[model samples]
Target: MKNLLVTGYRMNELNIFDQKNKAIVYIKRAIAGRLAPLAEEGLEWVLTPGQFGVDLWACETVIDLKRERFPQLKLGIVTAYANPEEKWKEDKQNYYRNILKDADYYGAVSNRPYEGAWQFKARDELLFRKTDGILLFYDEEMGEASPKFVKERALKLADEEGYRYIAIGADEVQSMADEERLSSFD
Candidate 1:
C-alpha cells in the first residue's frame, strides 16, 4: 500500500485551454496508462496538490483508475493553505472544489491563509515527507514558475529519503500525443 505524490505545471504554464487541449488529453491518458503498472506494483494512494493542469489531471486519472481497475486505490488532495483556491478564477475554483469533494481525504498543509513563498515550500516538503514515490510532469523550458524547479526539489528530497520517482517531460508528452493522433486514424 505505497503512497505516491504528483506535481507539475499549472494550466497557464502548460497552455492548456479549457481542458480541451488535445495534448492535455493525451498527456492525461499517458499518465493514466503509466499509473496502471504502478498500481499493479503496489501503489494504493495518490496525493495531489489540487492545482490546475498536471496535478488535477493526475487526480482525475487516479479516480478513474480506482473506479475501473484499482478498487482499493484512494486520492488525497493537499492544499498549500486554507482556501488555497481563493485566488483562482470562479470556474477553476469550482472544479477544484469538486475534486476535493470527491477525494478520499483532503487537508491543508497550512491551516492559515497563504502568506508567502515559504508556505508553498513547506507544502512541498510536507508532500515529500508523506509519500513513498513521486510522479513529476515537467518541462525545463517553461521558466516562469517552472515545474522543473519543483520537480528538482522533489527529486532531491526523494534521493535523500530513498524514495522512487518518475518524471514525464514535455517532449515525451508531445510524442505521446502524436502517437495518439496517429493511432486514432487507424
Candidate 2:
C-alpha cells in the first residue's frame, strides 16, 4: 500500500469566499476524483499538514472515502512543531484540535517549539521522505507564497526521490470539468 502526502493553499490564499465558495467546492470535487483512483490502486494512508485549507480538506476527503469505499484508508496529521496552532484564534485552534482527534496518527516533526523556517523545511522533508507520492493543490496565480514554495520544494524532492507527483490547480479543475462535459456528448 502507498502513502500519499497532501499540500496546498490555505483558505485565505484561495479567496474561498469570493465566488460563493465555488472554489472550495471545486477543490473538494477535484481532490475526491483524484483520490478515487489512488485508493483503488492501493493507497493506504494520507498524510496532511493539518492546515486550515487543502490539508484539512484532503483529510476529510480521505475519511469520507474510507467510510464509503476504502475502508482501510488512514489519515495522519503532521505538524512542524508541537502545538503549532498555539497562536491561532479559538475557533481555528478548535478546528485544528478536532482534525487531530479524527486522525489515525498525529505528530510533529519537531518536538520543540517552532524555531523558524528551518522547522517548516524539516517538516516538509519529513513528509516527503515518509510518503510514496504527493497530491498538491497549487496555482501560481493564487499568490499563496508559502504553499507555492512548499509545492516547488516538494516537486524538486519528488523528482530526486522518484516519488509520484500529482497536482491540481484551478485551471486543471476547469479543464477536467470541460473534458467531462465534452465526453458527455460523445
Per TM-score, the best of the predicted structures is 1
Off by over 4 Å in 1: 141-144
Model 2, residue 185: distance off in Å is: 17
lDDT (Cα atoms) of all candidates against the true structure: 0.83, 0.82
Model 2 over residues 1-186: C-alpha lDDT tens digits? 399998788777776633246556667789999999999988988998887788888887888888899898889998888888899888877877777777999999888987898888888888888898889998787555567777777778767877788888889878876776899999
Q: Estimate each model's TM-score.
A: 0.91, 0.85
| Candidate 1 backbone collisions, by pair | none
Residue-by-residue lDDT tens digits, candidate 1, 1-186: 399898788888876769777777777887887789989998888998888888999988888898899988899989888998888889988888888877999998889998888878888888888898788887667565657677777768767877877887778888887887899999
Error of 2 at 17 (Å): 6.2
